[model samples]
Target: MDKFDKKILDILQHDCTLAVSEVAAQVGLSTTPCWRRIQAMEKNGIIRGRVALADPEKLNVGLTVFVMIKTNQHNPQWLNDFGQIADEFPEIIEFYRMSGEVDYLLRVVVSDMKAYDSFYKKLIDKANFADISSSFAMEEMKYTTALPVNYL
Candidate 1:
C-alpha cells in the first residue's frame, strides 16, 4: 500500500458508508483509480469487512467488565475446551490468549451488576482455573472501534 491506500483506509475506518466519489475527492484521486484502490485493499485483506456500530446503552447493555484468567492447565485440550466454553457464552464479547501472568483475558458485557454476577458464576462453573480477576469500568472516558492508522 502507498500513501493513497493509507488515506483510503483512514477515511473508511471513520465511516465506511462514504460514497466512492466522496472518498476519491478526499484522497485526490479520480473515481476509477479510487475504486480500484479500495477493491485491491479488500482483495488483499487490508479491508477485512464493513460493519455497523451499535449503541450498547440503547441495547440495555450498561456494564462492561474485563476478566483476567490464569489457568492451571496449559495443555492443548484444556485450551480448546476453554475456547469452546467462551464461544458458547454470548455475554463474552471478546476473548484473547495473552502473554503475561494471565493466560486469558475476556471482555464481558451485561445489563447490570446482577447480570454480571450471573455471567461470572456461569463462567467459573464452566472451567477450572488457577485465578480469575476482574476490573469493572465505572465509566468509559473514550472508546473507539477504529484501528490506529498512524503506523501506516
Candidate 2:
C-alpha cells in the first residue's frame, strides 16, 4: 500500500458509497487504476467490508451503557458459551475481551431506562459473570465508526 492506497482508504472510511470514479477524482487517480487499487486492497484483506451507520436516537434507541463484566471462569468452554450468548443478544452493540480488572466490556443500546433494566436482567440471567458494572453515557460528545487513517 502506497500513498494513493492510503488516500483511497481514507476516502472509503468516510463514505464507502462513493463511486470508484468519485474516489478516483478525490484521490487524484484515473478510474481504472483507482478501481484496481481498491480491488487489490479488497483481495488482500486491507479493505474488510463496508457497513451503514444508523442513528440510534432516530431509531428510538436513546440510551447507551458500557457494561464491564468479570466472569467466574476463563476456560475455553465458558468463553465460547459467553460469546454465543452475546451473539444472540441484539441489544449488545459491541463486546470486547479486554486487559484490565474486567474480563469483558459491552456497549449496550436500548430505548430507555426500563429497556436497559430488562436487558441487564437478561444479560445476568444468560451468562455466569462473577461481577458486572455499568456506566451510562449521559451524552455522547463525539462518536465515529471511522478509524483514524493518518497513521497509515
Candidate 3:
C-alpha cells in the first residue's frame, strides 16, 4: 500500500459514512483511483465490513464484564462444544482462547446484575468449568475502532 492508500484507510477508519468523492478529495486523489483502491482493499480483506457504532447505554446494556475461564478439558471436542455454547448467547460479544493462566476469555455486556445472574446460571448449566471469574468495568477510559496504518 502506498501513501494514498494509507491516507484513505485512515480517513475511512474514522468515518466510513463519508462518500467516495469526499474521501477522494481528502486523500488528494481523483474519484476513480480512490474508489478503485478502496475496492481493492475490500477484495483483499484489508477493509472489513462497515458498521454503525451504537451507544450501549441507549441500548440498555451498559455494563461490561470480562469473564476469565479455566477448564480441565483440553480436547478438541470440548473446545468445539464450548465454542458452540458461546455462540448461543447474544451477550457474548468477544471470545478468545488464551495462552497464559486463563484457558479462555469472554467479553459480555448486559443490562444489570439481575441479567448477568441469569446469564451466569445458564452458562454454568451448559458446560463444566474448573473456574470462572468475572470483573466488571467501572468506566471505559478509552475505546476506539480505528487501527494505526503507520506499520503498513
CA lDDT of every candidate: 0.93, 0.92, 0.97
Better of 2 and 3 by TM-score: 3
Better of 1 and 2 by TM-score: 2
TM-score of 2: 0.96
For model 2, the run of ten residues with the poorest summed lDDT = 143-152
Candidate 3 matches the true fold with a TM-score of: 0.97
Question: Residue 93 deviation, candidate 3, in Å?
Answer: 0.6
Q: 1-152, model 1: which lDDT tens digit per residue?
A: 78999899999999999999999999999999999999999999989999998888999887999999998899999999999999999889999999989899999999999999999999899899999999998999998878877787
Residue by residue across 1-152, what tens digits does model 2's lDDT show?
A: 78999999989999999999999999999999999999999999988999998999999998999999997798999999999999999999999999979999999999999999999898889888899999999999999877777776
Off by over 4 Å in 3: none
How do these models rank on TM-score, best leading?
Answer: 3, 2, 1
**Highest-TM-score candidate:** 3
Q: For each predicted model, how many residue pairs clash, with residues at least 3 apart or on different chains?
A: 0, 0, 0
Candidate 3 has which clashing residue pairs, if any? none
Give me the candidate number with maximum lDDT: 3
